[model samples]
Target: MICALTGVFPVTQARAQQAPLPEGARIVVPGHGWGHGRGMGQWGAKGLADQGKTYTQILSTYYPGTTLGARASTEDIRVLLETSSDVIASSDQPFTARWSNNSIIATSDATYRYFKETWDGTNYHGGSIHVYRGAIEAHQGGSSINSINVLTMQQYLYGVVPRESPASWPAEELKAQAVAARTYAARRKDSSRAAGSSYDICVTTSCQSYGGYGTKSSPTSSVTVLESSSTNSALDATAGKVLMYNGSPILAEYSSSTGGYTAASSLPYQKAVPDPTDSVSPHHDWTASMTVSEIEARWPSIGRLIDLTVTQRNGYGGWGGRVLQMNIIGTKGTTTLTGYGFMNAFAWPGRSNGLQGNWFTPLYWRGVLQSAPSAVTMYAGESKTISVRITNTGTASWPVGGNVHLATNSASSFATSTWISSTRPASVARNATDPTKSSVGPGQVAEFHVPLSAANMPPGNYSQRFALIADNQSVTSLAFTVGIQVLVPWVSEAPNLLTNASFEPSTYAWR
Candidate 1:
């Protein structure tokens, strides 16, 4: 197949003949949304709250068909705060600690240690000995250290609400967050991400950011005044309430932003929905620019990357869907991977960051900016022009900053004398928008006005292909074709060399 580019011959080949990706091509992937778009978008919540929507209204919008559920009175949860050898526990008020029926009392100055002989999941539950509010338990689990914070769901959320969502946000927003955090904690079952770890949920993104009872992080006491009054009030406003789907707390996953649309989940309530107010988020729309060379470096097995083809998407909003499966084609071989797998590959040495989300589209470098006339018709000596557009897709812009030309091929018979060579037509015209630009730059589209003349050719039909060239090397082989029907010049005025000069003319001339 005649692979992509401009030349003298008509590019009669099918679209499959488009050239392979330039090895050093630059690609810009414009994307929408930020995180793993499942569940509610935190920014959307803040925006809704600011618009006078109640927390219940915001929650119902995100988690469709979910209602507030009742929680057990004085429910408690365990949050993994830290991991260290020396476990320390202190409290301003005298608190009691017991392990295996052995109890000890300690006040603020004189601290006491609670050692769990075995984490039977029930032996040491809460540090609340009269007022263990300022207590953090550092226990030993199988030769490793794990500092667990045991507190009532309400108080724990008092610390978590402000940390997950900024404490300075609106009251309704914080209340929504408080309810989400509470639901997330109440429904927690297993969060064993590491060996010898025995905690219901660790205070990290894996579960959610929980700021013990005091500070933003662990190894700190639950200082009441240290907590945000705003967050505490928000928690109080939405006390003992969790999102219920089917008689249980629904998994109310949340992230910093959802771009525009929340991702769908297996859960019935976590369906993909539009988040219009999410525009308040900085990550709502984003772009990631890169080169094909870096892609090759990431997947050495693929040699040089030839192309990236997204095969399947989830079929939702913005770009129609999120990439589900794609093919990474290269010189050595082709690798098929799911959308997440492709993202994981970007974590290699060169790629600065992974793609924000699967919802992205590699955008236009150059293409048929304006289509050439569907047909061309002209008489002898008449001129018809075609526009060719090009962009800097490879190592350098057209002509390598020298001068790029939209030229004809060696065999094209339609080449006019004005052509640079029998094949080369003219410098690719200036930027489509600016006339002064002489060469196409990166991400810029330059036009070329190819003058087709019919003066020298016989009138049947003609076809020629054009391509972009710079520095004597082929910039793009993806040629465009122009077909013209050159008819004989129409007769307007004609002179006749009359034989007898209208009969009397010969006699008069002879006289």
Candidate 2:
């Protein structure tokens, strides 16, 4: 992922080293690891192989206590090649296809053929190309559909292993990856049915990366045939082997790197283990620096972020620990987020400023509440409007509609009827220069207002308790007094010590 940075921050090292950042400036954060940090670490596997570990040893270390067994390769698997309204099905040599009308047509050595529904054909080597099982629907360009390849599990791995891991890696590592990929694909053989398609898996990273037939036209055609030959050897060597526990294939998930330690896994076979070999990976440890203002732009509801802390961690706790929960303390309130939640809060696909993995150090400024409305006094059945100005001292943006709101608390004395004309108990809007703008960026003020009333209330002081609502949840509470004074009716008469001083027609007198 790439990030764009601008503004007055120094560019030259000499200038940056000479001057300190202005007080309250945002700090830079460094991060480590990559991917989800789950299952087999490809770099870690390579490290283990370099140390002369065999394929079985590597697999045993990653997926502990699993047995290697063979399954029949007769079961065919479907792999989605591309999604288009129309697809061209071809082979290196002449092939025959069966159409939807149950008609078999033999082609005169055509490189490709267009089809809509089912079209079953064969390659020069007698391998079958099945395009019949998925939707024949088109998106975008119109009149296009997706193409699928039907082949044995073994043949699918021939294209997958090379695309996922480098073909030049040690043979033992390649074999381990081949088995892992095969097992991963085998377990999801029924996925196509659930997805209402004919193919069981896709050709993207969402599934195992697959490029069919080692051809330039393959989805991942960048890989050369020579490079694929090495991985092909690994697939042949492993044949139908898969790591099994209790007579079933394990999930067999894998990623690029695990930094120094694997993530704690719930599955007994996918346990955490030290991967010192993965140190060779460039992303094993990395640093990312962003201004506090930049981070605040993402989470404005937290207010001016004063501090960020890891409140919880998985069983693995340390420099490489996986954060289970985090708390963002701002001037307005503290926001708690889960590990995955924290990732999504900042990192989006194709966007930068996100951690590579859950492991990282955070440095930020605390958010602050700058101002609040004063206590209001109103007669019973009267209304008074109030506003509170809050400053986001933290590193997240206060979003317009969802993250910033005024919510009455349980201890609030006023009933829903006390709010002047609104149906909801509380009404909130963003503090924008133009009423139409929605968000309050970092270092900006969010002004919340509502018409408070004292209708149908006894004559006494009551605390109208409220809290700031962010991300559709309440973060903290505040309160102000609303004194609902009695409406004393009086009559003008000769001064008596406790008598009303003036009245035209008094409805009631002070008791």
Candidate 3:
């Protein structure tokens, strides 16, 4: 959850008292909400009840012309219709369709004979019923069956579409505009290529998550049939379309829902799945983007955000695919920053069947300032003590569970050194907020102290640096240097040379 910030300056009293916002500058308000505001808003659904709307009305309104239908497979729709009761007598027969777990089979030979006799000499598919039954498997498993016409239990009770606007553009114009927008959106992927992407098809309750408003009675809706579309299709032309600042059209991708966006990639079934009823046969694949104007208009509080774009021609399979890039941008007119980026790929054959087709690997990255004390500098044979405090002022917290390193460099090129602490210096302390203490909470700090004793040590100034290491990620604190000043006598000449060490504290002595 920790995020870095680019450059941020607080709005001071002077700026506030100076003047109104400069023209053309944008102020982006950090909107506190999740997901793309779309169909069946959970909060909105609850609000419907407050407004005195029934559950039926709520579903109908959100679905817009979709009807309530029974579930596709169920027992309620089976029938025993008898058009002519006198035509058949079953005094010694029981009417039943036996079935194994796999399939159903007809047990009674009389039942088969009756069906065959009934269909004989009739206009039944230009073939005999006996011949047809012979072609079909019977009693292969542990069951028999007499098939009956069963209305699919599932039914979508669709509401009639209201009349369209009389003055709106004709259907053809709308379609063309949508197509153009989609085509343009798809082509915007410059150097990046899309390869090794996965795809997911969400339909029914299997792939799409279904939460029935806490109703105990299991409800059913019409089963949505999947149709392979050659390309992407617009979810809504009049309602959910993304519009430009002007009264113009913008390429918009509509989903039944947006699970949410996060810094880490989501698992196969963990992400939110879109409504599967859309058809892409007419439109082209598209990418996601945000214009400067769009950002300003959408986030009116944050004025024109500045951004540094890094475009990558990276794809899994090879070139002529999706592109990947990261754009570091300042938040609005102010200097605080964040990253905006996405990886997109072209639609290839058999690519629309899984979650990999559209990777939501978007990042909202930021930079943070880190500081630490280097190694403790002390005179050889002298005792030295050092301490460090790590703080975080960034939008996010520092990483937790990282290693803390304490290193020292000696002037004598001394290869042998022993640390008194039995364990690694980093693992001695624990924090409630972060056990590792590496992830110092935002506005939080951690401190550590280390003692070094140089016995019979050489006289010299030594430097040391402390570092934090977590797996492949690491951040080192500033270096803490200790100047070990040793007293040694200065020899004027060969006759004045001193072989014994000077005992005075202030005198410079040497061996």
Please name the candidate that would achieve the greatest TM-score relative to the true structure.
1
Candidate 1 residue-wise lDDT, 1-511, digit = tens = 1112211112111122123565555666767776688877899999999999999999998889899997863777777876767665555555666552466544445745778475555354344322234346666777778877777778777767777888899999998898888888877832332333456677778888765544222324343444688989998888888999878888889887787777776688978788889999877887666666677777778776655766666666654567677777777887887766765655222555446767776532333334553567888777777655654443334532345666675545677754645345566657765556665555566666677777677788877777655533334434577788888876642235254335443433321
Task: Compose the digit string of candidate 3's lDDT tens values, residues 328-367.
Answer: 3445444222212221121222233112223222211122
RMSD after CA superposition, every candidate: 13.1, 19.4, 21.1
Give the C-alpha miss distance for residue 340 in model 3, angstroms.
5.2
Q: What are the per-residue Cα lDDT tens digits for candidate 2 across 136-223?
A: 2212323555466777787778778988899999999999999899888877874556676556888889888876654443432353
> Order of candidates by lDDT, top first?
1, 2, 3
Name the regions of candidate 1 deviating beyond 4 angstroms.
1-20, 84-134, 189-197, 214-226, 344-354, 364-447, 450-511
TM-score rank order? 1, 2, 3
In model 3, where do residues sit more than 4 Å from their true spots?
A: 1-385, 399-401, 404-424, 427-439, 451-456, 466-471, 475-480, 485-511
